[model samples]
Target: MKILVFSMATIMKDVSMGGSQRHLRELLFHLADQGHQITVLTNRRQDNSEEYELCPGVQVLPILRFKETFPIPYDTHPFHLAHSYSLIRQYADTHDVFYIHDAQMDYGYLHANIPTVASIKNFVYPEAMISAFHTNRNYLIVSCDYMYSCIQYTVGRVQPQITDQLRIVKNGVDLSVYKPVEATRKSQLGLTDDDFVLLFPHRPEASKGIVQAFETVRELKEKLKGPLKGQLKGKARVRLLLPRHFDVHVSKETEQFYTQLTQEAKEFQVEESLVFYPWVPGHDMPQLYAIADVTLCIGQFIESFGYVQIESIACGTPVVVSNVGAQRSIVPSGYSVIKVDYGDTESTVEAIAELASTPMDITGVRQFLDQNYNYKENLLGYEELITSAGKGSSSVFSNTSLKSGSPMDVSYKLAPWCYVSGPKKGIYHDYFYTYLNQHELYSFLSTCTEESFSQMELVEAGVSSEAIEKAIEDGILVLYTP
Candidate 1:
């Protein structure tokens, strides 16, 4: 079968965008191995490469950029949607099935009148969720039950109508790369045998709980300085390893948050306990996971599917995860997975102290992961869905007419706010929330209402191109036809 995949983001190696991208890469590799021809039409990376071969035979084309205007976030953005429609018209005839990576991208596929299967890897916006339910396709693969529940909650009572389309295909990890391995980076990373290392392998986002890790470490230090000092002789140092950056797309707000976190750590007198680890590419993540005594996935960030927990467990590392979202559903009764409440600092510290002395027996967890979270089983689930979506499809390019000069095509405007009664200094939409200087940001967006500014015009207005680019990526400033 010939497959055409449409996504806003797809990377071959450096997976800084997290598990969703990895999930797509693995699925395409599996399909390619099974003799299906796959071509990916995705956004260009920072380096601006035109084409790539993800594998030996699978082709990846970076052609999803907004050509007529500056790029914006992908959810129903007119430029992106129109661009997607234009591309689908070109390739719809040759591909057997259209595999869309995000539910928000369903608009183009729905109107194409072709066999389409979409994966809801993240929380779908209300607009996209409503639009997707109006589709004629039968297959809508959600990553886990949590995402399914989110979509249902977003759609309210009418969810029953779309229930037939929502299929739960739990995320999986490749055992070949994530299995138990020797701790090869302990000494190289300046760790001694007496040190207890906790790998907080998450982005520097506040929701990912870097502050919670710091608080837990500070409390652990107090415990060690007192009565617990004599009990654990060899465990003198407790370090929480946090990566500095997840990707090159670090926003200014993230930088500010990270800076504030470090300052707070110093104020709490726990700066020595925090070790900011360098960025590790996705391919070297197993080695990074192997060096840690415990993996921390505790935070307010509700995961659609907690890939970190399963991936850490797959490497024979015990995980302390928040009791929320798919993390709780995926590994309910495993000793390797210790669940704590979102902000329970005392409990998290206690859990870390207990794990410092005791080594977990991950045999049962390994067996469980092999049966459920193995990549092969995951491949089969998606393979079945893709094949089913392709069955009895005979027409393509059936609906090529689009709103060519619609208001969404001419200029740029502020995307709709997800919350109107919320804070005035922040932009909250989809999965991102970044506080901004109201005077600087609001004035710029207000000016955009009059007319779109070119790159030079923006510079002349004293707005940095970086700020506009960031706003575009954040969906705060979007392409508008008028």
Candidate 2:
């Protein structure tokens, strides 16, 4: 099967945009090896001329040519959606199945008339998009039970018809890379075997709890640094591997946090407890995880399935995670995944301090990972999703359509297609059409009086404001007031 993926994930050892991209890349390579032809169209921008590091069988291309981001969020960004549509238009018809990463691109694939397998990695998918796909029942991929619940509760409110398409394919880790190993590379990393490393192998951002990590370690430095006389006792130093820049396209808010973190690290004297290394390569992650006594993955964002916890546990390291339903849902029973309140630095420090004495259960954690989070087994699940979606199976990954809960206002309606007869022409009506998409048009229609629509709507929908005025001149659409 030829799969055309419209996601910003790379199968190569290049810059990553976090877990979603990493999951896609891992699955794509494995699927490529399974004899499926894979092609990825992502936001490489310009100047991303580095070679793709995957098998020669897979093809990767950049959807956007220019570099830079729209300052606003995705909900109102027409420019970003236009770029997505341009990419979808380029290859939507040619592929056997469309695998989309986010709900913002639903309009692109819906019109393409192809079977789609979309991942609802977050709970933020709009009701308009969810309702749009009610007729076709596209496969909505979810990574964990947490996100599955989120989709059920949120989208189910606006569209009760939305639940049937949802499916769970739990996140996986390459256990081979994450398993415990001798620190042959310890000295090379400028560390002794005796150092009590507390790794936070993620981007240096506020939501990632970098601020908390610095504060927690700084507070616990004096307590953990004493010379010990035990089986694994050395000068207890907390070495943190924090990436300088995040792998994804971050806004100024996160950029400000990043800038502030670097400056305050010295002020907080975080270096005393945690040795901060910036931008460590992915290959070195296993060693870091193995060497560390405790790892902090206290991200504030609601993670559908956090890779840090999975990888840490797989590497036989105990982790301190955000106290939330999302991260908690993935942890196996009897496994100690320490939870800390979102911004409670004192609680986080206590968790770390408590974990400093407990030994990592390498055998047990690996068993948990193998049983649940192994890449090969979960890749098969993904392959099944693609093949089943291609076969048009209503029986997706789950045995039944999902259930629902909380009310999320994903309020937008798409305009229905209309037929105007004047010697029937193409798929569309005989003459001029509205500039806005169904969601945008209906939203405008909601705000406008019954007698008239606004020129701003037309401009927002990619038509110039003058287009409506010109259309009125050409007798395309009559212009009047309510």
Q: Top model by lDDT, which number?
A: 1
Tell me, by TM-score, which candidate is best: 1
**Sliding window of 10 residues with minimal summed lDDT for model 2:** 421-430
State the TM-score for model 2: 0.71
**What are the models' TM-scores?**
0.74, 0.71
Q: Local error of candidate 1 at 89, Å?
A: 3.7
Could you give the C-alpha RMSD of every candidate to the true structure, in order shown? Answer: 13.6, 15.8
C-alpha RMSD between model 2 and the true structure: 15.8
Candidates' C-alpha lDDT: 0.67, 0.59
TM-score of 1: 0.74
Model 1, global lDDT: 0.67
Worst 10 residues of 1 by lDDT: 393-402
